[model samples]
Every structure is written in C-alpha cells, then in structure tokens.
Target: MDGTLTINGPKHTDGLTVERQEKPFHPIEHVDARLISLLDMAADSICLIDDHSRILLFNKASETLFGYSAEDVIGQRVDILMPQKYAEHHDGWIARYLETGEHSIIGIGREVQGQHKDGTTFPFDLSVGVAETENGKQFIGVMRDLRARKEDEQRLRSLQTELNQMTRINAMDEMGATVAHELNQPLTAIILYLQAVERKVSKLADRGPITSEDVEQLSDLCGRAIQEAQRSSSLLQRIRSIIEKKEPERTTCDLVEIIRKAHKLSLVGFSATDVFIDLSAPDDLPPVSVDPVQIEQIFLNLLRNAFQAMREVEQKAIKISLKIVTDEEDRRDRLQVRFQDTGSGIPDSHRKNLFKAFDSERRNGMGLGLAIARSIAQNHGGSLDLAPFDEAQPGACFLLTLPIASSPSDESEPKTESSESMDGSQ
Candidate 1:
C-alpha cells in the first residue's frame, strides 16, 4: 500500500482491487498557476513531456508553431508534433537517457523538422532539458522556427552563383583580343587547306586521265581540308559553351577528361605548337567529386595563369601531374593536381596574398579567378594552394586537391523511422 499510487475510487492492480481515501495529485494543478501563466506567455514554443513521451504541458507558442490547440495535444504523445523521420529517434533517445542515465541530445540544441497538424513539416531548432517533477522526471523542449534563416541562406547561395558567372564572363572579356587572334589562325588554315584541295582538282582536270595515284592525292587533300574546318568549328563551339550562362548543375566527372578540355580551351591565344604541356595521371584513379563545369573553370584558370606566366620564357612548358594522397589528419583520400610551369616564379611579395581577391599584378586581370577557385575548392572539402618555392625549381607551381567521389556500391538506402503517434486519455 505504501508503494502503490493512491486513488480515491477502487482500482485494480496485479489482479487485486485497491481502495484508498486519498486524492490523486495532478501535476499541472499542483504546480504554481503563476508558472503556467509565464509559460503561456513565452514567445518560443515550449513543451513538457513525461518519461513515456506523453505531452503534459504545451504552451501557447507551442500550439501556434505546431498548429494544434492545448486541449488537442495535452495527453497526446509528443510524436504528434514530430516529423516521421525524427519521431522514433526522439522516443529512442528518451528511453536510452532514462535507462542508462546518459544523454544524446538532452540540454543540447539540435535542428530537427516538426510536423504540423496539417501534415506539413518545417525546420525548428530544439533544446531539451530534464526537470524533476512530483511524480518523476519530465522533459522540457524549447523550439525556434528557422524558416526565415533558411530563406536568407538560400538567397545568399543564389547571389554567389550569379557572381561566379559574372567573374567568368569578365575573365573571358580580358582575353577578347587573344581569342579573336586564335580564331583567325584556325579559320585561315581552313581556307588554305580548301584552296589546296581546289588546286589539286584543277590539276586533275588538266591531266588526261585520272590515275589511282591522282585519286589518292585528291582524297588526301580533301580529308585535310575537312579536318581543318572541323578543328575551327570545334574550338568555336568550346568557346561558345564557356560563355553561355546556365544554371549551375553538379555531376561526378573524370578529372583527366576535364583537364584535357580545359587545356585545349586555355591554349587559344598561346602558340600551341611552341608551348609544350605534359600531363600524367594514374589510369585507375577514382572519379572526382565535383561539379563538372565549376571544376573545369578552375582548371581553365590555372592553365591560363601558367600560360601567361611563361610568355617571356624561351621554352614555355607546363607539367601537370596527378596522384592520390591520404590526408594525415583525417585519413581521407584526395586527388592532388600539380601545375608546374617553367616560367618566372612568383615574387616573394605577392606570394603571401596570392589567393586574395582584387590583388592582381597582371594588367587588366580581374584577380578573382584564383580566389574563386580556392573558394570553390574549399567548399567541396578540398584545397588550392601555391606550392612553396624551391630554389632548384624556377617557375610557380600550383597544387589543387579535390575529394574522390564515392562509388555506386558505397551508397545505401536511407532507413525510415516509425510514423506512429498515440493520443491517450488524460
């Protein structure tokens, strides 16, 4: 009788009828009405639940945030206000905390989605604490809606993307004269090839009979003409695609293929025949974790920088090497791309703030390329840096590191949590 809960009416427990003349204490009734009045007036959503996760007290803000009245959820399970994905986790953590006297989320603020009575979910920041009550322990949760903050972040991301596109356009503008000159070379070559083809045809007409040798020569000249035209057309198309503005889309891509494209595109103004580029990478390297177009922009920027640096040098050469590296601090695998140019090395004065924005030494240069590239790299859990100068090596060396994409086999289906919520009698 001493260990049992006292009830005024007869009640059955363990198949035995127990009668008592004592009145059962109501937690909300026993607590000071003034505390309840303060809770009702609080701005943030506040909810109190028992060990079984049943809602004991729900304030005005809680009712408004969850689209439910106090009477509707008073004796209901707390899961009613939680999204399906997080409801089970809420109960599990509570059970574990009570049994093991350990906490996974108690007194710690966490971002979680809350489900409204209309079945819509929204993000909220939750902070939970345990309070000692007359009956036992009750958990109090304070939640703040995050919709406005989330909207602000989304808008910021959009603005950043627009800025990146504009920077790329400005970089192209700086190379306007060079790109035009390069385009003229390919077009002029095509014309010369076509003229040679026409001359061969005229010679064949003058000759009495068309021999196998004559046919072969004409075929070879025509093929060369077609090749020259295709080269000009391809280069134009590549440039056009680069300047075209499009919404950013991300996809996994091969680093070697992107490097090759960027290298070809970057050599537009530079004498391709005079400048030598050597690229080497492992055949079995994993795919790069990056947005193909954004990563291509980075490659283009580094290549163009190297090409410009070697303008005065007699032998313009760039050595690009790629290899896998394991970060010692985190044990994460990354791909490192090295661009070592045989040109006048970076001056010591400009080395410290190399990636800083608007600090260009080159005439008419935007100085944003490296800064943007480094920002993009870091955003993808990677890095971009100028290799420390070595007395033995004369030219500047830029090292870019990127994460390796996870393989298809590494992905697993997401585990869904229970979607149950109970509304029991008060």
Candidate 2:
C-alpha cells in the first residue's frame, strides 16, 4: 500500500498519516497601515469612505480642516462633513456611481462648501477617487481649505478698486485743465465786448436828452451787466489758476466781503424752506492778507458741507461770525471766521481723518473739499481747524484764521468808505 510519511509528533500506527493546518490571511493589514501613515502626513485633508458612504478613515489634516476629531468622524456618514444641500444629494451620487460606473466628479477637482464642527461652512477644493478594496468598493477624497485664498482675492479686489478710483481722479484733473484752457479766450472776449457796449451806452446817454429816469435806469442796467461780466471773468481766471497750480496772488482783501460772496454762491441751488443762515461781521475788522479767491473757495466748501450735513435735520441753521483774535505766543493779530452749524455733529471716529483725501464719510462725496480748504488756508499762512465739540449744543463748528495784513500801504489805503455792516439772513 502507498503511504505518506508524517512528521514525528504523535505517530499513527495504522499507517503513515499526514496532518495539515491553515492560518487566517489578512492582505490589507500592513498595506493599510502604510497608507494611513502617508495620508496623515499629507497637508490636504484625506478621507476614505466605504460603499455604504460611511467614513472608514479620517486623517489628521481632515480633523484640523473640519474642526473634528478622527474618533468623532470615523464610522459616521461622510455627509456630516458637507453642507446640507450637498449632503442631501451626496448619497444619490454615490448610489448612481455604484450602479453605472459613470464618473462625474471622480478625479476632477472642484470647489465646494464644507461644514465645520461648529456648524459654519467654508469653501474647499475637493478631488475624489474610486478604488476597489478586498472588503468592498470605497472612495478617497482630498480636500484643501480655501479661506486664505478667498481673503487674498478680496484684498486684491479692494486694491483694484482704489487703483481705479485714483485713475478716475487723474483723468478728471486733466479734463478740468483742458476745459479751463478752452474757456479762457471766450471768457475774455465776452468781458471785453461787454465793456465796449457799456462805453457806447454811456456815450449815448451824454449825447441825447434822454429822460433823467430813463438815463439813470439805462446806466444802472449797463453797470450791472458789466459787473456781472467782470465777475464771470474773475471766476474763470480763478479756475484756470487753480488748474495750472499757479501760486496764489496774495492781496489785502476784506474777509467779510469774501465770506458774503462765498455764501451767495453756496446757496445757488439750495432750498431755503428747511434751512436758515445768519451772517454777522463787525465793521471795525481789519483787512487780511490772503488769496481772496482761495479764501472764498474754502468758505463755499465749508458752507456746502454744512448744508449737506444738515439735510435730514428738522431744525437746520448755520451761523457765521467773524472776530479779531490775537496770538498769545507771538502777540500777532489774526482774523478768525467761525462757521457753526446746527446739524449732526462729527463723530470722534471720523474727526481724525475728516480732512484726509479719499477718506470721506459721505456716500456721494469725494472727500477733497476739506482737504483742499485746509491746504489753501495753510498756503495763506493761516490755519483751518474744527472747534472743540460742545456737548450742550449738538453741531459742528469750523474756525478759520488768517494773519492780518500789516503793510504800510494797507494802513494808509483809504479805509473803504463803505462801513456797511452785513447781517444777511435767509
């Protein structure tokens, strides 16, 4: 009889007998350990899920990205990491993939929202892969948080907007210069023609025995026409000088007169139904050394700002008062004009940057008015500042000071015979 030899353990005497035994084999143990180590070392989050959509593995990065611990996420459904809308369709997607091997998002990286442990959602880039394991089919996903990238994008957009605004301002400056240059010749011609017409009208009045009343009326009309024409020419010249950045032509001028002109200009299109203005100036105030046109511009800007600030207020009023102030440090006299408004006061937060260019609080403002006004004052050897806030009265006050013209010619120049005190009200 054919017999097989058995190893010496417990011998069977009937014949030579052999015994065999088999041990359980697990192919994925060592490989799985190595894969988990690699996944944990990755910067992006990595998650592994079974065919049932249950999380089989969650790496250290996934824990950090989702603000969840591995112990909390593993064995749970993967939809917990996704937003509600995405989670609702996630199961159907996996089911369809299982049925038809059609890969819609597999291997394609795309942006999606990831829900955090605290219930907040953030953007992330996700790339998914399908694999066949010894146990079953599974999905592997790699995700990268996009919060930093999104912040960088927002910063870039803000910078671009500022650049665009600066570009627009530069273009406007060039256009203003061109317009002023084009307007100069026509404006001069208009003033000259008006003057010639006035002279001719005056000659006619002297030649004929026109009724005294008619002659006086005609002279009055011609004088007014010539005065308006001259005013227009002066306005154009001021614009040209400003656009060309010419140095201001300083002269001795009545501060009260400049204020009156500026106030009139500021109220051109303003409605008086809800607003009142009171202007007071002393007749004994001395002349100031300043660029009259620039000072007028400053006054106009301040008045316009006050009007706009009080547009929504029920009781709106602006009071302008002029007084002579003496500097204690140098014993020098200066003229100060105070503009007080009964409107919304400036907040402490806005006061620091109120005169800074491009830092306006008003929605439709360019934030250049106060800056330009202050610059003009400084150039005139004067200063513009906001007066101290008075809690008792809720409003804003602006004080402008200019050095008094002390030249011998200013003192000897016939004190303007006009001692008319102005108390304008509207």
Candidate 3:
C-alpha cells in the first residue's frame, strides 16, 4: 500500500507515513522532532491548520500567543482561539470557503483584531501561507500585536488638540491689550468734552431761556461725544467678533476719520509720557471704503509700536500726514497716510522681516504689533510699508495706502486739517 497516515487503526490522508510492517527509513522520527522544536522556538507566533479548519499542529509560540497550551489546541476546532463574537460566525465562514474554494486570508497579509485567553481583544497584523503535502493541505499563520503603535497615535492626536486651543487663547489675549490701551484716550476725551458742556450750561440762571449760540455749542459737543462713543463701541464689537470666530463686519467708511480716531487714542500714551504730535493733512480728502473698526486697530498697533520705540528718547514726538494721489496710468486713486516717529530707527537686519509675524526686536515686547497692523491694512484694500529713515535723525516711517472708493459720488468728502487747524488739544 502507498505510504499514508493512520490514526486509531484507520488510514487517513493527514501526512505521509510508512507501513507498520516496514522499517522506518532516513530517521523520520528524529527529523519530525527537530522540526517541531524549531517551530516551538520561533520568535513569532505560529499556527498550523488542516483544510477542514481543524488545529492540526500548534507550536509553543502559538500556545503563548493565544494563551492556550499545545495540548488544549491540537485537534480542536479553530474557533476555540477566536473571541465569542467571532466564534459564532466562524463555522459559517469555513463552510463557505470549503464549498467555493475561495480564499480571503490565505496567502495574504492584513490587520485584524484577536482575543486573548483573559477575554481581552487587541489589534494584530496577520500573514497566512498554504502548504500542500502528499496526503493533505495545511496552512501556517503568523501574527503581531499593534497595541503600542495605536497608543502612541492617540497621544499625538491629543497633544495637537491642546496646542490649537492654546494658540487661540494667546491671540485673544494680545488683542485685548491693544484695545484697552488704544480706546482709553478717545473715551477720556469724549467724557471731558461732555463735562465742559455741562459746566457752560449750568452757568445759566434757573428757567433761563438758553441762547441759540449756547444750544448750538452744546449740541456740537454732544454730537462729538456720541460719535466717539459710537467708535469705541464699534471697536469693542469687532474685537469680540474676532474672538468668537465670526467674520469681520465691513462697510464703507471715511479713511480720514479712522486715522483721526487712532491718533486720538495714541495721544493718550504720548501725553502720559510727555510726547508731542505734529499732525498735518490736506484741506479736503476723498474717503476710502473699509472697515472703520479694523482700520483703527491698524493705526493703534502702529502708533503703539512707534511710541514704544521712542520711549527712551528725551524728546518723544510723532508726525502724521495724509494726502490723496491718483494713479494716472491705471486711473486708480489712493488715500495715503504717513506716520513717522522720532525714535530709534530699526536695524537693517530686522527691517527685512519687521512686519513678519513674531518679529521681536523691542525688549519685553510680543513682536506681533506690526504683523497685526499689516494684516489689518491688507484687509482694508490697503497696505503698510516701511520707508527708509534718515540716517542723521534716527526714526522709522510707516506708510499706509488705501484704495479710494470707486464711486466718489456714493459718499461725502472727508474733512481734513493742517498742523494748526485741528481743535485745541485739551
């Protein structure tokens, strides 16, 4: 008879075996024992199965992998190593495979989840191979755990979320500092003007008929107070909207008025430090459409930076000038304002990236002032540029140029003043 396997005194197509009557050749038993030892000592977990999905052979590595002894696994159904959830459907999978001869995992490698003897499920990468023998077919499977990699990925994702939150908080904090310092001056001015008007009106006798001149003066002061207060309220709203992630509310605005408001705020810091301002502008200027609140923010940032630059100087002064120039070639018009500081000029090396985000040169400063200023300028269809400072007189000049409204008829002309033209500084 041909060589074959026999179990319980019955022939089976499991493996090749010599007839009982014939002498064993080529030390077959020794070879089999060495092969089993090699599989037991393998670094990777190994499992051997027959074509019927039965556990024909399992090494020490496989026993440790599935938390089962070799004796408990051998000759058992493969579903014993699977979790209860998977075991319920494993029999049907085997039956379908046997009938169709289709292979999903055979000769392929993929990722899967596996169960441990302690009722824990973990991720694993698996590779399967098929082996054909003289009497029967078998399969070898290798598996590796992925718990460590999965844990590391989760940690990285959490850190990214935390970093994003911190960035937003820092942005809001910076914006708050700017608004507080810039808006305080104009607010104080408005209050002083209102007080002055009240003092003048109180001088009249009780039930006295107030003159037209008195009423006109009082109305003018009240209107100014209302305008300044409205400006402050609008600025606060803009800052709040930014913190809340809402789009900035933009509308047609007078560019000259926005600059005047910014200058008013900066005057506070200058006065506190005993700095003087020399402001000049054309008699009449055209208005540029933009977000008034954002333009004010731009001016506030620039003025603050300029003031901080000259803080150590004995004579601190700021010069502001506005003009309207039309582009002959392109037929485009622009409103330009120049803010110059009589302070220490920027170093050549630092000037290259002065407006860049996080450009830190001033001591104990956040270095985001110029960056925010430039962003605001750009958002208003305008730009901020650093001009060459005079070497003899140390100072820096920032030029703000905004696009003029295309339809000049849409709005009234902007009011302007010369160096000596503005209302007295109270």
Candidate of highest lDDT:
1
| lDDT on C-alpha atoms for all candidate structures | 0.77, 0.72, 0.67
The runs of at least 3 residues in candidate 3 whose Cα sits more than 4 Å from the true structure, single-residue gaps closed, are 1-245, 267-273, 327-331, 362-366, 406-417, 420-426
Global Cα RMSD, each model:
12.6, 24.8, 17.4
Better of 1 and 2 by TM-score: 1
Which should have the higher lDDT, number 1 or number 2?
1
Candidate order (TM-score):
1, 2, 3
The digit string of per-residue lDDT tens for model 3 on 300-340 reads 66776776777788867777788876656676778888888
Indicate the residue-level lDDT of 405 in model 2. 88
Q: Give TM-scores for every candidate, taking all chains together and pairing residue i with residue i.
A: 0.76, 0.43, 0.43
lDDT value, candidate 3, whole model = 0.67
Residue-wise C-alpha lDDT for candidate 2, range 1-426, written one tens digit per residue: 234343232223334332422112222325467778898999999998886677877889999999999889777889899887887567667655765577789999999999999999999999999899776678999999999999998896566445434533453364465545445655676666567667767887788865777667666656766666676666555444434433468899988888777775555445544667766765566789888877887887787677777888888878887776787788887888888988888888778887776795742362666776787788677899989889977788999999888633444444332333322242
User: Model 3, residue 216: displacement in angstroms?
Assistant: 20
Residues 1-426 of candidate 1 have per-residue lDDT tens digits of: 454464433222233333433323234656688998999899899998886677888999998999999899987889999877677667557655765588878889989999999999999999999988766778999999998899998897787677777887887787789988867876788788778878878887897788899788878877877887788788778776666777656577788889877877776665545677777776566788787777888888887777677778897777788877889899988889988888888888888877887786732252688888897788678999999999988798889999888533333443232221111110
lDDT of 2 at 48: 86
Model 3 lDDT, residue 124, Cα: 74
Count of backbone collisions within predicted model 3: 0
